[model samples]
Target: MSRPGQSSRLLICCTALIVCQFVSQLSQAGVIRDKLMERRAQQSEMEEEEAATNGPRFKLPPGTRVLEDVAYGSDAKQKMDVYLPASAGDHSAVRLPVIFMVHGGAWAIGSKTHNKVVENKVARWLPKGFIFISINYRMLPQLLAREQAEDVARALAMAQSKAAEWGGDPDQFIIMGHSAGAHLISLLSTSPDMVAQFGVHPWLGSVSLDSAAYDIPAIMATKHYGFYDKAFGTDPAYWRRSSPLHALNTAGAPFLAVCSSKRPDHPCDQADYFVKRANAIGMRASVLPQARSHGDINQQLGLENSYTQAVEDFMASLSPAIRRHLE
Candidate 1:
């Protein structure tokens, strides 16, 4: 017979062996799972990249027309896609309002074809009787924020010149942009001189879709993320010069500043501050606070939600006839 202490030691040894085996198996399984997940993530990214390059996959509504790669300038990046709404008999007789879209990628890398978020907006609004024009601008590192704004202005001028050909009203242009694009449009709307300088017909109003840097000086003063460094850079004077808040003295078109209420320093805080400043300066401005991510604030605008309704309401305020036609 074995001694009690010896038997206890034997049992403990067996238990330890069993535990070791189980742990080894678990470790192997975890490695396999991680590898599989990584592969899946890579595949998904590849698919998204392909889709963005190819443009919107979904077919447009009947009678809607899309003019792709229309050159607004000499550079390859100075291209835009115009979507014209269908009309009854004579398309030229029906003058539609233009929604000039600007895509956002921190003002560095984005394209009219690559930003798929605007695709849904195109689908939703084109059938509703609005001519949508999604544009691309020269990016950062090579071109600063001010230059990018100038590029947008030039593109607007080009689009305005070609608006009548596509059954769009040159005078009824409404600027809409997300994030960095929002910042650019906000700059144009507040600084009437910039619009005047561009020599494009005056825009009816603008919809700023969740831009955080309305007040660049304030942003530079706070603890901002690393991206702002590349966009705004280390210059205080440039910050003020590019700032919409700093350029808000001139009363221009009405503005609907939509922002995400989630972020602490932006959209919520910055948007409200911007609107207050604009109102103080006698410019008609309104603040829209949405509980969404920065990107979602742009992507979900034309969807069937209160957010979409709010945007529609703002557009209606710009032109009641446009709203009537949609209805």
Candidate 2:
């Protein structure tokens, strides 16, 4: 028979093993949930695209059309998709305004294809001709955060140069990205000088940064950003380089900074710091009216009437020059 002390030790060991197993299972479950959300978002996107021609009932305007899967690159390796209004009767010669849509995946696992909903919604649903370009850039483990931003910058430059081919005006380039993609575009707007290192022009117009992690250093406190530990070291200087909060200065893109109320619970406080910094330096900056969660902000961009008056009103406030140029 086993001694009581031996039994007690065995019980403790078994408990430890079970606890570890439970943690591992929970981690796996979290990953599965993430993948499922991504997959569903993609599925809804394809369905919406297929249904665009039907009407507002299908959540799209009839004149709007998609120019799927175009490869916008100076080289063969880089590619992107542009969704546009089909050559409707009189608008054939007109070049529409363009928003380059960047999908978020925490700087690691997202695709241009990941944001199909936004691509279709913005491109096909807007009554005024709005062309959407979704891009895939080199991401984490392979290149990390800074490189991911570079990929977006490169894609934007290519989009600007090649806009005419897709019936979009080269002058009006809006960088709209969600979550990590929002973070990437925010960095591009605040630190256009960073992309100058890559020989790309700073964007001409507004950056719609939706649910972006503005304060990356602040975000690093979360477990997921810990995954960034290897690339962005523990040092404040290194972390600052990746944070949009640190990059807010007198220069860069005019910003339409949209944050979800449900995320960070106090985005006004969190986003205010960056918005004020940008404004104090004379960079045009404004906040979006809607108070959506991070997921809701991006998720809604794929559907109609999601933030109806709020987002549309904000877009309507842009410079008439941009509106006319896009039209």
Candidate 3:
């Protein structure tokens, strides 16, 4: 016993509920879009300010040339700064090896020029006829760690394509990074699939400075700390894929893992374990332990300290002059 208009009323109520749900979703999306725009705008402004102050911050040596903000991808963060040495007699006939550096900020925040480290590194190496390149990649809570590794690989691919134009030897590029950058570059070094995916060139060697994320499963096996869960989640499969240690199966390029002796359970422990695994697989690898803080291990590099000498020894091993120097 229903009223004549009862069915019509029921249909009207259902339609109103659906419309309300749609409107609510639209409102939420708009809020997200607004927040994203704000973050992007802030990042752009900070970079602009840094650019304004660059002249005083980066003092170049005589016969040095710097090419800044060369784009590798469509994203604003996909850019690199190249530092070239002064022209020497018959230098054009011989392309020099490139030092490709990736900066570290816990996979969240960092730039190619962070802390004037790149400037110092450039001033030191450009005089020695090395072309130094620093890169910037898209950061997190926007992209995951694996995706960031892909970005690094893409940057390498692009860099190799343009290395000769910038006086760099594409076939002899060396990859180096500190902290999170170390993690990303390690993946590029170990993961053959990733290298093939991104079309990276055959790099000479890799230097990982104080990176703890080489063994992601081991890190996850213990009590987790800040930023680990964020970059790598609770998935075991993903952890294995992200781990550089796990990625090593066959003989690959040589690696110099310079770690902070003061830090526990990482960079040191991981470096030792990685070297063992790498050697077991017939790869040339070694760990250099230094008595310094993790930050010092990065910032104090290229200052010709004992630690710097150790790194140089590793770099020298990779050089074409190794046999000549030995002779």
lDDT of each: 0.79, 0.63, 0.79
lDDT of 1 by residue, 249-293 (tens): 877889999988875444668888889988988988999899986
Candidate 3 lDDT at 94 equals 72
- Per-residue CA lDDT of candidate 2, range 27-71, in tens? 999998877765553342223122212112224455666555456
What TM-score goes with each of the models?
Answer: 0.81, 0.70, 0.80
Better of 2 and 3 by lDDT: 3
Q: Candidate 3's residue-wise lDDT over 1-327, tens digit each?
A: 767699789889999999999999999998887666545433422221233224226577797777888888999889888877785234568777788999887777767876544766776667777788888888788788888999999999999999888767788788998888899999888988889987986888999988878899988888545467778878999999999999999777899998887754446988899899999999999998888876677778877677777787788888674322212
Ranked by TM-score, the better of candidates 1 and 2 is: 1
Going through the candidates in the order shown, the clash numbers are 0, 1, 0
Model 2 spans with C-alpha error above 4 angstroms? 1-69, 72-77, 88-93, 115-120, 123-127, 202-204, 221-225, 228-235, 264-268, 302-308, 321-327
Order the candidates by TM-score, highest first. Answer: 1, 3, 2
Residue 233, model 1: lDDT of 82
Instruction: Kindly report which residue stretches of model 3 are placed more than 4 angstroms away from their true locations once superposed.
Output: 1-56, 88-91, 321-327
RMSD values, in order shown: 8.2, 7.2, 12.3
For candidate 2, list the clashing residue pairs, or say none: 97-326
| CA shift of 320, model 3, Å | 1.6
